[model samples]
Target: MDGSAYGDIVAQPNWTRSTHDSKWAGYLKSSAPDNTSRRLAVYRGSPLYSRLDHHTMSRAQLLKLALPLVKTHGFTREALSRSVLYLPGTPHAEPLSETAISALFGDGDNARRTLLDAWLDDARTDMKSAPSPIMKDVLASRLRRNEPILRWLPEAFGLLISPPSGVPPLDPSPALKHVASIADEACHIVGDTSLGLSWYARRASVAAVYGAAELHQLASPATAYEFLESLLSSSSNIENTLVNTEAYAKYIGRSWAGIIKSSGVF
Candidate 1:
């Protein structure tokens, strides 16, 4: 975990914490808006992770440090290596070996994937902190965060949907999970306390809308908010349809199972 090195970095100017033992952890907590902290408390799945050990803390700092380099280095190991220089007087400092980068972040695509997760999670949290209760405004806040790295988003998206095997036929789970998290945060922000099947349906609809709006944003950032509004307007129909279909499917499946059991087909 390089605990000693993390301690040294914590001692650096601009990172000292008078209130908490872990300076960097305190810094991260204080930096987020009060609303964000509340939302994070309600949804432990939110990106403001709680396990703040030296390893986790160091990686968080490293990702933040490396984010800017993405503009120049295109989410490559070179950027991560360069970011090490900023953490001077540490075991993770400059001349970062490939092994160190691999240890800090996994090797190959997984490492860049981690970087993408950090970027998206931060954006999602920022979206939750928007003052507006309107879903479209919240989504817009999130999409706008991409502007700084918009030029490279296609590559990031590619990394996101890319299969871990590095083969053709993209895996959508990573992207799906990302959107689902965004939807969950949005629902929390808007005070949507839906439960049962409705909870799943609501989040599914929000995720679908946000996902489409995000893709639209990539092509036409100027009109993305309008597209998001249109999607939101139609979401009720989609949610109703999904809920009915889901309910019907469950009923039919259970009835068939009951019939089969009664018939002693086995």
Candidate 2:
């Protein structure tokens, strides 16, 4: 696997840290198939990943695989956001998306949008429990991107976030608004502001990226470049580091990619 894959794998929910490194070694041994490869191929005479491949993994599995990834590596909130953005459609994902979830999120979609938007609008918040380590030059690399993500707008941003799956298709932006409403109520249901903030920040970061990228759909090339340049140049201006990095990096990348309907400019 390449760096990105390795980075992602270590972050997978299946991974866990033991009190001893030997546990990891044992896991490595157990995960392996025969003497050929560690990759699990046929579980009970079928492709081991068949369910995951078909986007059939349940929500229980999704959370298990994804949460640990976030916690272990402290994966960026953007990464966390992406994970949740696609949760509704993930294989085996529970019916977490509910309308009663956010029915009280104001009357209109815009109001719901605003409610959802605020969950992670600020950068100072620590959105994820497992925070990714400060990657070498990742911040700088993001700031330096020649263009932001291809095409995105804040409203359409949810589409860019989440694991790739085909379980179901949703109108991601509205779904996000709904999800945010659900999330908001869920937090209140639990009565924890900090926990709510933590829950939404990562999810919001993912939307912000998609929303920012969606703007490219309306922006001219020069406009997009200038927007990205300004974002990068003004990093010091933003009080929040996480927000700034995400807006400039993952979101920007997604926005740049959105324009081309791909993942990146290259």
Candidate 3:
């Protein structure tokens, strides 16, 4: 098929590489498992094909032209997520709503710094008391989506654990204390983390809940609540024991709690 036809198919929100053959085989035959060859053929035929020449245009300029076409075609969140993970230097048709354009371009460098600062400020404000419930809910909501904060957590931890130049030194003890308080509150909502566990086990129970929520994004559109439910339902005795022992809560209390605590120098 020609570039226009291919572009039309790709523009659809639900379009996948598999969709090309299953849905639009009349225009193009399935040449390979992936539609890479077909996509290249279409690109070669499109007006933008000439612009691929590095000397002819800058990467930013190409993205400026291509983004409109991508949006016009109806780019989906699933496609954008995959592109962010798989296509590094390549320009995406659209940015993920939770991610900043600058962060996406720099692969979370800017985002990590921004979030770390925010977390520090928030933690300091609540150093003497538990973090506000509203703040906990806000964090939980962001963790559920494919947002920049979730994506940048590992890097943020890296910085917190071993701060680079100009990055301030941090003491994670206050953050841990706050996390423990939130976790204890969450336990009260679910069942009880203090029932049969030691003090360390109780702390670990809280850590587990936060860890589960942070990882929930990896399983996306499926929420952290659903994932926790599934884990609770697991047949394995150990799995069941962990959730039950921890008193798995409906909502993650302070999703960044365990992360901030665990990334300390100690």
TM-score of each candidate? 0.69, 0.21, 0.29
RMSD score of candidate 1 (Å): 8.6
- Candidate 2: segments with Cα more than 4 A from true spot: 1-47, 50-210, 240-266
Cα lDDT tens digits, model 1, 1-266, are: 44454454444322322223243333343222223334324434433335334444555566666666676777777877777665422634355678878888788877787777666755665675676977778877888877767778888888889887867678888889989988998898888988889999999999999999989988998898899999999998988898899889999999999999999998
Per-candidate local distance difference test: 0.70, 0.33, 0.40
Order the candidates by TM-score, highest first: 1, 3, 2
- How many residue pairs clash per model? 0, 40, 1
Model 2 agreement with the true structure over 73-170: per-residue lDDT tens digits: 22223223233333322332332233322332222243223222322221101121113322112222222221232232333345334213433544
Off by over 4 Å in 1: 1-26, 29-56, 88-95, 167-169, 240-266
Q: What ordering of candidates by lDDT runs from best to worst?
A: 1, 3, 2
Q: Model 3 over residues 1-266: C-alpha lDDT tens digits?
A: 25544454334322222333233322222222245345445544655444334222222222222222222222222222333322223544654454533433323343333333334332322222333343344335434322433444454455544433434565555345445554554444444434444545554555555556655655463476566554433423554566565655423444556666788944
Worst 10 residues of 3 by lDDT: 55-64
Off by over 4 Å in 3: 1-117, 120-148, 163-185, 188-199, 218-223, 232-266
Model 2 clash number: 40
Please report the TM-score between candidate 2 and the true structure.
Answer: 0.21
Candidates 2 and 3, the one with greater TM-score = 3
Error of 1 at 138 (Å): 1.3
Model 3's TM-score against the true structure: 0.29
